[model samples]
Target chain A: MRFDLIDHAMAVTGAIIRVLVYSILTLPAILVVMSSFTNGETMSFPPTGFSLRWYRAAFENDLFMTALWTSTYLAVLVAIIALAIGFSAAFAINRFSFRGKAFLQGLAFSPLIVPAVVLGIGLLQLFAWLDLTQTIYPLLLGHLVLAIPYVVRTILASLTLHDQQLEQAAMNLRATPLRVIRRITLPLILPGLLSAAIFAFVTSFGNVTVSAFLTYGGRVTLPVQIFAYLDTSSDPLVAAVSSLMIVVTMVVILAIERLIGTERLA
Target chain B: MLAPMIILLTGFLVVPVLGLLRSSFLSGNHLLEGSGFSLEQYFHFFSDSYYTSVLVETFFDGLVVSLICVVIGFPTGYSLARLPPLARRWRMIIVIMPLTLSLVVVVFGWLIILGRNGLLNSLFVSLGIFASPKILLFSRPAVLIVLVQQFLPFMILSVMSVVTQIDPVLEQAAANLRANRFATFRKVIIPLAVPGILVGFNLVFVLSVSAFITPRLIGGSRVAMLGSLIYERIMAELNWPSGAAMAFVLFVSGLGFTAALNALAASRFIVRGRRHAL
Candidate 1:
């Protein structure tokens, strides 16, 4: 059989088309980041110069610092609380066959689909009624609601996929339920829980819609802070902050990818 | 175990939804007052042609965006799903990049690309496509592009999950029967993938309908999607009744699409069963 030149040419053409498609899709996001560093007062297409002035200004800005810390603290707090509560909820449902199980599962996952603005309004109303609107607690609670769904879903998936027979074997060996869970189930699903925590952390950290309504003068998240800055004052400083956040997020993603396989996490 | 979750959901999701429905019935004047509970808000929103037009436009946008996402996302997801199990990990990561990013960040990125002096305009100019820069930002098309990109990950993930569940042997059998490439795909793969495609459609529909930031940021004053309108009424107009009404409409339409998708899946199941019986 003769080697087919036409088929090889077609294969090369197909690969080229795929590359073009990917570049077309990804170019806009890269352009946005590049444009944010423009050296002009008004946003320009091509940069006039290369400078790190924006980073310097943003680093020196106290408002940005406060918002960054607030967001970090809120995300950490949300991750801890959500992991604690959501893990328990996931464990219960996976271990037992009980009434209203489907309903409970539905409820746990409902927040994932619920619109952020609607949830923001609901939380805003609830907090106002309880006189908790201005406090950081409401912000924390709102983030918790958002983050819990991810934790619950990942942990539930993990629990479902883990070997149930391992627990049975442990019980046969005279291990108590708690010990079996701790020694067997926990170890198996710990990677999942850890990965979920990271996902929840990034989510709460970067959230805006819910945080926008809930933010007071002193209780804004980083996204809200950047939004306010963008609304009132257009500066490269916003880009510096955003680029920093992107770096932080990318680092975390890379770390998680290395720690546990993305396949297992997915 | 389930009690806390159920209680929280009932108090939060169910009650708020009911409250939204109830608020949609009260008059604009007596919205906050406890006494007035009429169908005036609905009458206002439905009767006014301007508001009705907005609703229709938003609905059309949702449908179009959903269709586009499904068309683009399914092929990409199929490509990922068909990869060897060992190669699936990196493909999954690539698929989830958009999902992991925040909406605000995504919109921010779009702002740069769609801006008047943005990269697209620059590239177009360099390519000799236009004499001057054309504004692409804040247009309807801009909003649609960003939205499709934002939700593409969800559709991919959903369809990818179901695609992975389909048996490879079915395709092999179809090929063994002398079915060509397109025929094999149509007969063997599409039937198994109907549910996942419907799932992707429902998700995209519901989300595209409710997206706020992308429309507001990219659509600007030229376009008004339902979510942006709801935000305007609530925050700017201080019309809580109207906001609640619009929210109720969005929620209903979302559920409607979901229900329709479910019905389509169910009928498909019935048809498949009859075929099997025959």
Candidate 2:
């Protein structure tokens, strides 16, 4: 009887701890979402009289709109480029065993270990030395480096679980290698590819560290713009912009969840 | 097939880093100055008391935050592993939701919560814990709090992955052998969980040490970390060589620390035929 009672107490303690930790994890995003709806000019908690004025303000601000446009197109280009490289690389790494394969794999994943700030500064120097700092190429290239690892990781997971027998069966039917890949392998890994694209998109879109170094003239990414704005001012427009980002992130996350299931993602 | 990735990585990632490394030895403000190589930048870093203290504090902060993540993450992970599949799936989404959001947005949330007359202060004051709202932002503790929040998901996921693989049958066998719950946990579960804990520790340490946004915003100008310091030197001061030296130092220390932990973990645990745990 005493043992059962102790077990019950322990279970309760564990449950409480889990709840607390989850709350702490979600609290920040929740607060940002809540305050973004404020009617007042300044941001305040227990927000005063809910309104969408700040969202309007965020949209009306040309600087933020330009940043949003820049971030969108930049992220799209990064996703497409990263997918091309990541898909080919993941396919090769997954299918073949050759000399220097391990070295190649490590090199591909190496960016994850390197600090983003280090990457930013190094790229900044490289671009400046090459006289390419004035163009948008630096941001694209920098974000591609940041996004490729994620794309490769997601696609590799999918490829590992893929059935090679299907590809072999298709090839045995006299299909060419390209046809077999297009008809069998590509179709099979479509979900993984979608998830990988989302990963690349989110990574490039949300990046600030590397983009901070690479943003030239007025072509800043949305997150970097927000960072700069926050450094100078405190207002509800920042909250509105942050909430929109959170919404976009949540939508992408949900889309990924729908495609691959959150279990594989987590 | 692998040509494009290799070429891109070598050109953009590898070459740029090498360029930065080469410039670190040069004595010039601008990167293209072609000045003669010297050890002046590294010497300046070591000779300066401020830079040295910042380096020490960065490592110290990383250790403290990683330790806290392990302490808090272990229990949560254990519970998560024991959860039913349906419950676990929904909860996993919640766990990863914050991770999907931009770090800047997350920091903004913290800014509101920890700001003067913000959620924390207002709540505390309403409860008479203090006569007035205390200044909570732009401090070391605030930086630590945000860092832990930012990186805790990685720790939880790492621990959960390992804990989920530990069979429940072992625990049942221990109980059948007359072991108590705590004894079963200590002897069976903890030994199996060490690899996961080490991985989580290494990850959190590396990430927190390299973190820039949280320390910059929450800690503000009051706190100086290696990430912010490197940014200041390179971006604000235009001291590319000095910044490159600091970046190299940060990279080498992170690599060395991770390698040391892996070696220690491998020698102590994996060599005893538990290699599969990692």
Cα lDDT computed for each candidate against the true fold: 0.74, 0.87
lDDT of 2 by residue, A129-187 (tens): 78888888889888888887888988999999989999989888999999998999999
What does candidate 1's lDDT look like per residue over B123-205, in tens digits?
Answer: 89999998899878768888888888888777777777788898888777766776665665566677778778877887788
lDDT of 1: 0.74
B47-132 per-residue lDDT for model 2 (tens digits):
99998999999999999999999878888988888889888877887888877788899999998999985899989899999799
lDDT of 2 at A193: 97
Classified by CAPRI criteria, candidate 2 counts as: medium
Residue ranges of candidate 2 with Cα displaced over 4 Å: A1-13, B28-31, B271-278
How much lDDT does candidate 2 score? 0.87
The DockQ value obtained for model 1 is 0.38
In model 1, pairs of residues that clash are none
List ranges where model 1 is wrong by over 4 Å: A1-21, A36-40, A231-234, A264-266, B29-34, B268-278
**Model 1 per-residue lDDT tens digits across residues A45-155:** 675577777777778999998888998998888778778778889988887888788888877888867777777766665665566767897687777777877888888
The ten-residue window of minimal lDDT in model 2 chain A covers A1-10
